[model samples]
Target: MFYRLMKMIVAPMLKIFFRPWVEGMENIPAEGPAIIASNHLSFSDSFFLPALMKRRVTFIAKSEYFTGTGVKGKLTAAFFKGVGQLPVDRSGVRGAGEAAISSGIEVIKRGELFGVYPEGTRSPDGKLYRGKVGGVARIALATGAPVIPVAMIDTEKLQPPGQVKPNFGVRPGIRIGAPLDFSRYHGMENDRFILRSVTDEVMYEIMRLSGQEYVDIYATAAKRQIQEAKKQAKQSGAEKQP
Candidate 1:
């Protein structure tokens, strides 16, 4: 109920303001379970994809969004819950992956759209990153759901990292590709090789659609490297100050 209400109220405002466009709407099945495997560009990727889609697409959000400690935290949690996002605890790497897989399987079992980012985290530099093999492939094989590759274009520009308000005059778009069927590897979700292959194929499709430069490293690792570089730069600046 809340999801529908929010969609009704918020979706149109987003559409008019952002002028977001989508291609390949017919690629989305009119009904039935499917995994929406998309490239993670910006935080707004979550908001725009769902608002523009006709059906409710549930994504696994980080648990921190739901467990904040202040008034803003409570409102954030409420908004996410109201929008029907499932929260997965990301403290433990292994546990978080398993929990996301389990949640995805349940969503697919109910014959609904389960959205996932195979890259596992938002791209640090707007480039497509190598996908982790655990979440999307494992769930798709486990539930026999087709994977739909979605590309969120120019979303990072709309609201870049650390920006509180979205900048106008930038038009975003979603490009949905035909669903990639993986029934040939049914019940082989445990095969690590198969998982990697499936994930890579999905990433390749996203790269093609979004036209993003492909990076073979995981997004998490890229973020870590970026943070380390920033720390080193700060240290060097302090040394020069003395």
Candidate 2:
């Protein structure tokens, strides 16, 4: 109910202000369960994708989005809830992967579109990163749903990682690729090698559609290295100031 209301208000606003362009939307199944795997470029990717889609796309958000304190936190929680996002524990909790897999399986079994970022986290430097296969592959194989590769173009520029507000008037593009059938790997959900192959195939399609340079490292690992480099640079600068 809240999701629909917010969409009614937010979708038109996005269409008019951002003027988002969508291609291959017909590729999204009009009904039934399917996984919508896409490249995560910006926080705005969440807002833009669901706002533009006719069918609801449910993504798993970190628990902090709902557990924060204060009025700001409350508002944030309400917004995400209304946007149809589910909260999951990403704080190194044991069985976190299993929890996510179960949540995804439940959603797909209910015959709804399940949105996932196989890259695991948003790209740190605009290049497509290697995908994390744990949950994505399990859900797809567990439920036998087709995985559709989606490319969210120019979303990073609309609202880059650290920015507070979106750059209005910038139209991001969405390209929905055809459904990827993994029936050949069906019933092999427990096989790690098969999971990696399927995930890589999905990522390849996203890279092709979005036209982003591909990086073979996991995004989270890359983010850590980048953060460490920045910290060292800052320390060097501080020492020079003395």
lDDT tens per residue, model 1, 70-160:
8878867776776789998788989988988999999999999999999988898999999998899999899899999999999999988
lDDT of 2 by residue, 39-88 (tens): 99998898888888889989888999888789868867876888888898
Which prediction has the highest lDDT against the true structure? 1
Residue 4 accuracy (lDDT) in model 1: 80
Candidate 1 wrong stretches, greater than 4 Å = 69-75
* Candidate 2 regions with alpha-carbon error over 4 angstroms: 69-72
What are the lDDT scores of the predictions, listed in order? Answer: 0.91, 0.90
**Model 2's lDDT to the true fold?**
0.90
Using Cα atoms with residue i matched to residue i, what is each candidate's TM-score against the true structure? 0.95, 0.94
